[model samples]
Target: MTTDQPVRAAVAAPGGPRPPQDGPDRGRGGPDRPERDGPPAEGPPAEEARRGFLAKAFGVTALLSAAGSVLGLLRDLLLARYFGANQGTDAFLVAWTVPETAAPLLIEDAMAFLLVPAFSLALVLREERPTGPDPVRQLVRATLPWLMLVLAACSVIAVVGAPHLVRLLAPGLADPQLAVTCTRITAFTILPFGVAGYLTSALRAHHRYTAPAAIYVAYNLGILALLLTCHAVWGVRSAALGVAFGSLLMAGVLVVPFVRGLRATRRPRRPCGPAGDSLVLIPLAILPVAAFTLTRQAQVFVERYLGSGLPPGAISHLNYAAKVSQLAMTAAILIVLVTFPVVARALAAGDLTAARDRVEKDLGQATALVLMGTAFLMACAPSVVALLFERGAFGPHDTAVTAAVIRVYGLGLPAQALIGVMVRPYFSIRPVVRRADDPAATGRTTLLDWYPVGAMALGLLVTVAVGVAATPRLGALGLAAGNAAGITAAAALLMRGLLLRGIALRLPRVLGGQARLLAAGVGAAALGVPAAAVTADPLLSTLLGGTAVILAFAALGTALGAPEVRGPVLGLLRALCPPSPPAAEGKLPHGR
Candidate 1:
């Protein structure tokens, strides 16, 4: 598959792998044919076509993810109104930490980053020898059993040790017992989430994105339903139970699609290859990725742990603020998710240039979106937080603290987006050797592999040190600042590492684009701040001010000639209202 082809479902040919039909047209002519064109035709419009496909796919995924985020927002609203940032909510948030920490390892972007490339490589290799045993199937079969075993052991440990873990995560909680009970209920989600991760990887490999994208929506919906129906009876513990049930529901939602994807790709197979032979390479690939995830998650753990030592509501404040700040980041991540598998596929096929191009584009676009979001959120943090979470048990003071924390977190949105895009290339880098027994198989052996882990470690250390040092004085604001510093450092290190490995990022161009976006963002804030100030009602202020800000950003971005802004807008317009057909021959009398 070349860059100019629409990513399509693979079909087997009798002789070999069939050409993907969705690619650019190669005019039919043997070498014997006379030349007819004035200039030699360039490569088929594959890049443009692929971009169109991505744009449409991203638009759909964004809509679904936005819907899920809304549900998540509602969940937070209920938690705030019903419980506020009190001991009960704090206890629940502590229990929630289990999933928060485990998600990156299982159902979040880290899992996708690690597995997509592996699955892509397996699929490509299998396609090369269509009649051979399917490597993807073999790989999954070999890996799943071990995954289940590890998951089961981890779940048992977590269940048995929930009390100890709760004490460790939030030592200052007023109601440690409630947290322990909630932790026990939430611990079981680890196994289901692990299963969901595998299913997500499988679906994405087959280019089946709808089901994977919808999994979060389903998960959130399940939680919302349970909380509504059972919260009265079960209290805050209901939310914990909801999480476990939701994880199962999340995985359940993907099973049929995953199975269908497998059936579509299935071929008559001989006995599978030596089962454990393929298993060695998986751990080799996963370990560094896992290390990176652990370090990232550790930052959150550190923040919450330190926040616990603050006022009673401090943990809940941090959680609420972080969730609101994350809304934009989550949307940016969903947009980038569309590109991960494509970049991985390119790398698996040994097209380094294509992979690099995809990474650069994804980084720029995600950054632009995130920065725009940062500008809006930071400028209107108070109004936004107040509108979203100021009613019921969530009082004005809670809104003020949460808003401040959100503003601080907004400072890091661009760095977060950059890390999200940059890390994928490292994960997608094809290994030179697969043998675990090889002396050079250690992760640190190559700069390509070692730098990401090193960057992550450095970031984690900075986060813990800064968070621990500052939280006592500045509370959640200090923690948010530490997170920003840490991620910024990580993003810089990752960019530097990529450059050292000769992957030129054309940093000047990227920075220039970012500068334009920043200018647009500032211009938007200039207009929005007053719009927000003029209104006394928080909801009215947010709606009116947000609309003005968005309009200003779009206008300034277009005037600045930002492709990241213009391209998507144009693509969406085209998608919604396609070009009109040419007037019929000699049929324009009415117009005349």
Candidate 2:
């Protein structure tokens, strides 16, 4: 597929045609293979092709992500075995918050939110039989330098103020000096992470997905390797070093692909004037997004701050539980990453129908997937936690705490998935004015808007209030509850905003599917709990209980006609055992 084609159309069908393999712009082959040569495929062929491609892409990504997640789980297991939930672990977690918080702002979801739309818009404008210079290149040149400068400045601030920052984030810490040292080491990651995020945005804008998707795997592998090799020398601080080195490794993985993408799209420079003015809209767009990101990240701040005041290891418990809960969340996010760019590009081109269709489809499928995962996780929380992290310093007591927290967090998985899906539409809605006479209208509007900001702010307030009130009495469980509540409220507001903006969500169908999914989940839990009770070993219990839950959910879901279950099951079958091509009319079949 050519760069000028809409991203949706490019991946819309499978086995259609493949693009030239030798072009300067040719990206590394992975999940998103090029379409077939010749005219675009249409009708059922196109639809089936798209579905097959999506299935393959989703499968490949999920497999790789699951690998990374396993490594992440192993990292936690080792940490639990080696360090336990003590002052050192708590201190490392506290210091870890810098990257955790900054990630959303610099290179994770936040950057995706701003840059996807910006890059999509740039792509759209560049394709418009240009009257002057290339807007995409112009936007990149204008924003990248300043973005790097800001990232550098933040890193310096974080390094210099590490001690003060640690005090503010975890005032009750038992070892402030140790945390400060860890914080300083982690601080250096901000710069490299920013560079990685920028490169990721650029690649995604060009509709390249493989390299960006592999980033986390690369990062986790780096950390896992470093921790194993250097733990004896640096102790817990080795984790901090792993973080910094991993980030640089993450950035390094994308360099060649990003440069190739840049080279493919490179164009002659033109003087900045009306064409370049659209570049200013990027930062403007980033502001409200940045605010929304900060508010979302603040939820973490609230959790950690309140958790710090609780008994020692409260923060670590929360961290471990969150990792287990996030596995499902990560799956939902991978789906979003694939679909969001298509939605953004559609909206940028002013095709609301396409954008709306994509959003609704993504929302339903992602929601169903998360709900099923939540059921499995919540039903088998104890077994799951124990199987993954119940070795070494992590005993039954620690397992119990983490399991309880995971169950509470399971309540909010649907809301978290929905929030991720719902937020994309608002970002994808570009302001287009019909009056051609207006000189000020540069074919785009500022990126930051009130809808996302207001929705997120309201959510943040609820999270802080609930967290503050419940932490003293209920401890880490309270923090989990607060997070669930805040995210649910935010998801609701965002959904309502979409409705008000005239984006039809087909509410009745969506709600019906969800109700059925919930029923199936409940039914699954009913069977799974007993199956688990029959087993004495944690690993065996998890295997038995999880299998029972998944099978029940699948049977009930198919009986209830849930698309989420049937679609994937069928897709996987089709992918694994494809049909044979038709024989020639005059020729006998091979068997005959």
Candidate 3:
């Protein structure tokens, strides 16, 4: 079957061979009804459509992020001016870390990882046969009770354990009074994350991915406003309150639309069985999911531990530097966030081939997108930090520390991109076709929705452990190493799970391409580094050096067949040029 084929047979040929299958027409009125091909049904055209969707997704997210970045820059500038990366910022950083970690744990993992993919799968399953009661509605209806329960439980746990968590994370918070105040504030607001998480998940499931994704920009803006408006009035406590208010505001926005959707879909066209009657079964899986997200939070806990040991402003310096890494190419991450559920649904329907294709396309695009961003950030790290935060309590020393961390974290950009892609298999919907060694099951395939939550949980633990060990030894640089190792290990294990389950990796082919991309990266870095070393002005030097490096990287990678390296470069060039009349022969017909 070609990539254009929409309906794939779950059944396998003898000895795990693929059975001959035709296109969508062949599967009409069958158990697996094919979805409408948005445009042409051919592979190349289909790939092009997928690219278009990704571009639009990227564009929307980028615009929103750019706005948020500008606002954050201003906010940080004000904080730097007033607070100047001192004890106040340190207190704020330690306080915020608890909730900030929630971005990945509660928002990214709880909502995006589990809920969105599960929701998307339901839609895909029902889309193949829309006449029946919508599986989408059934899933949503069943999901709510569990979401609420989890929210309440998380709130109680956070409130009860806040002080202990503070002590564990920031041992330096020896002042009983200060520690108690920060912990109380942080715990009071933790419930908002639980509420916001479910609401965001609901929106994602409804295909309103953009709004909730963008809601974060507002969340950040609120924080920015709080810092600027209240810092002078209420001091650090006000800053903590700002975060609390921001999270609550985010929760409010997330819930309003979600509730509307809930009311609209109150009754399903087709009722589900008792298993789907409550969210209990679905949320049973959240333990693994929560574990997966918590491991990410553990890294922040580690940072706070090591951070408290540093000088007064050290935690704030590390925090700012981490944000540079986190927010850089954030729009691209959002694009991935939007696309993941769509891909998950395809994977869950026993469509391994389709899943593989979607993974490659999105992974390839994301790799290119992030690589360009890495190049830009690496070249201009000092300048970027200086321009954004230097005016505030941010001084030369703080800038120096932050820039150093950013440069080190920059080294792990590609690895993080790869990790993002590798994690997808954990949520894959591959069919357990007749195992290669099993013969009686020929032409039979069982859809296996393996939510490798266990692997994810293990991976998170590995990541946190590695990060903690590395950070203490290497300083900020060690943190980056830990991140790479943990994520790489997690990704490796996820892929291995597929292999262990009998899916072929075609290692030689994959490695061959990766080698080419790596070579290009190295070659670019080789020249860029030397140029940067000799240049007088760091920012200007970076601009000149980075351009040379990217040109070299793109040329070499393209020549050597790195699809990840070539596709987006061409897309970017196309985006730059104005639309022109169709050419006759080689020359432009007009307006060239």
lDDT of each: 0.76, 0.76, 0.60
Tell me how far candidate 1 lies from the true structure as C-alpha RMSD in angstroms.
7.6
Instruction: Score candidate 1 by TM-score against the native.
Output: 0.87
In terms of TM-score, the best-performing candidate is: 1
Residue range with the least summed lDDT across 10 consecutive positions in model 1 = 32-41
lDDT by residue for model 1 (412-497), tens: 77888988888877767744223223343444434467678899789888887888788778988899889988988888888887
Task: Return the lDDT, model 2, position 505.
Answer: 80
Tens-digit lDDT string for candidate 2 (13-104): 11212233344433223353433111112366545655565565667667777777877788888889888988899999999999998788
Better candidate by lDDT, 1 or 3 = 1
Cα RMSD (Å) per model?
7.6, 6.9, 8.7
TM match of model 3 to true structure: 0.78
> By descending TM-score, how would the candidates be arranged?
1, 2, 3
List model 3 lDDT by residue over 274-393, tens digit each.
Answer: 322112122233445556566645656766776676657766777787777766556557656666655665555556666566566555566666665666566567766775677746
Error of 3 at 28 (Å): 23
Model 1 residue runs over 4 Å out of place are 1-42, 270-282, 431-448, 568-592
lDDT (Cα) of model 1: 0.76
